[model samples]
Target: MSLVRISHYLALCGVASRRQASRLIDSGRVTINQQLATHTERVDSLQNLDICVDGVAVLAPQDKQYWLYHKPIGIDCRLLISDPSSLIHLLPQTPRLYPAGRLDKDSRGLLLLTNDGELTQALMHPDFYHTKTYVVQVDKPLTPAFLTQMAQGVTYQGAQTRPCCIRSLSGFDEGDTFEIVLTQGLNRQIRRMCQALGYKVIDLLRTKLMDVELGCLPENTMRPVSAAELLSLTQLSELTSLS
Candidate 1:
């Protein structure tokens, strides 16, 4: 293997993102062959190098694993200090696994977890335009105008959101329920869009992302993604890369 930058190597090992890996090196938490490593250092041979992050050895996984997790509301997607409610702690005690995309603490539904950093980068990259679908409940009945605005793209904080697909789900005991599909994953995007239209989101649940669906998986549980699913994901990544 060719010599790779420490940050990129660390990212491939699932220790952190490239930027986070650089920060780790600068903070003196990373060591190469038992000596403190610098952000500019490169690993001549991944197999021969002894890389450690905060005393934990960093090694790339031989086989990347992908999982579909039904994250429950109130559980954080990222690891939290001393917090068992985090997705990291909830997952099996395996190294190098990280969430592909995040669902805020108040939101719940399907979340993808994987050890493949490259795949994560591809799926999360803005250029990929991966679609994510959500089932949302709002405090008021949705007007045709509201739906139109959402589908046509609404301006938020001086920037217009990308056009999205929106449909009303039949039968809601309270408030209005709608299915929204977005190609962009903005921070608290669904909630913010509703807020901008004078609607308060009471509950938000992500139902699908790309070709993966939440299905009937129990909350707080996870299972390996199927081979067919992985193929679809990889094909999508390849298409994005070419584009």
Candidate 2:
């Protein structure tokens, strides 16, 4: 049987994350064959091995965890604090993981959390150029001229933005809410783009990224990304990376 890193085994078994499993091993909480483990321990997932956590036998590894978190406004996605009320503080105990990209504290919606470095890298890589969708409520009822200009992507805060897809939302009260898809994500990108067009943002929420839709998942809740979605993302990423 091919042996894999024990950490990977831990991740598959749902014991913790690869990173956290390392820490647990270092802290003398993880044991293999009834002996304390080191970070270098090798484990064959299909082989006979005795694993324990804090003296309790570790059950067989489960599938890897990948989740989408519907972040609310005013909470940072990268922090973990004790206050459950704080948006940053509401995370499950697992391996060390961070959000794949930036969504300002003022913005709310789809945020990806994963321990898979390869997947995160694929999403963040500039070459991937994956499309991200946003539902933005701006100050004014959008005009044709303004929307046309936005489609061309005017330069703002330096470099010109790549051409984007825009569709106006009708029947919304007050300002217009639009569906916009962007490839390049500069800092405060949508907000800055709106400002450049003399529009003020009332609410901003990410609707989708690549094949991963924010879905109907409740606020501040998370769920694993589906296999089909993951395959699509990975395929797109690989194509771009190879090109």
Candidate 3:
């Protein structure tokens, strides 16, 4: 019997990322063969262990799936009891998946949804340092000092942000439009950074995540992750280490 960590098994079943699965186990939500499971415990995959979380049986591992969506502004990535505009309502019911990272309801752009929990963990973990690109519009005109300070890094909420690449976009009629590439995703990071610099973000749109791009995708649409894009992501050091 090939024994595997329960967290790995849960991740394979798309229950959650490995770390999150560990949390679930810690909270006494996971069971194997009707016995409570632990994070360090392993089970034989070939044995077809009766794994349950909160009394719901976990289905066998399914083929990994990946998708990219152009999230529209005003739509949340979460499934909230009170919010009717959550993105989950628009997605198909089969092949359950979760968003790799969240985009603010006020922000519109690319979001990756997948059943690959390992991939999700790799992308969301700060140590992986995956890059996301965004085009932002602020409430006022751009200043050289503002651009330089933003690129250098901004201190906000008692923590300093990592240095990021920022470039002003010319020829756009929008006031103070610029593109920024970030490796770390904090809560409302771009908006918070701009606010700390005395600039209010008028619009924020993410165009890319890692090697995946939102190119030409219409708003409120989703597409399967292309083979080339998946290849690029898997080739990254962080993902390769997962093997």
Per-residue CA lDDT of model 1 for 1-243, tens digit only, reads: 668888878867776656566778889999988999986787764465688988978776446788999988999887764777777777666655778889999999999888776677678877667999999989888778888999999888876799999988854334399999999988888988888889999999999988899999999888999998999898886786587
- Superposing all C-alpha atoms, what RMSD in Å does each candidate have to the true structure? 2.7, 6.8, 2.4
Q: Which stretches of candidate 3 lie over 4 Å from their true place?
A: 79-83, 171-174, 237-243
Over the stretch 1-243, how does candidate 3's per-residue lDDT look in tens digits? 577899988887887788778988999999888999977788776676799988889888888888899999999987553679887787666677778889999999999988788788788888766899999999988888888899999998898999999999963344499999999989999999999999999999999998789999999888998999988876773554664
Candidate no. 2 TM-score: 0.69
By lDDT, the better pick of 2 and 3 is 3
Candidates in order have lDDT scores of 0.83, 0.76, 0.86
Give the local distance difference test score of model 1: 0.83
Residue pairs with backbone atoms closer than 3 Å in model 1 (clashes)? none
Q: By how many angstroms RMSD does model 3 differ from the true structure?
A: 2.4
In TM-score terms, candidate 1 sits at: 0.87
Over 1-243, each residue of candidate 2 has an lDDT whose tens digit, in order, gives: 568787767755655445556777778888888788887768787865788887877666444457788998878754536545454456555544456676988999998876554455567667657889999988788888778888899778677888899988874344488889999878888889889989899999998988789879898788888899778876875775577
Count of clashes in candidate 1 = 0
Question: For candidate 2, which ten residues in a row score worst on lDDT?
Answer: 78-87
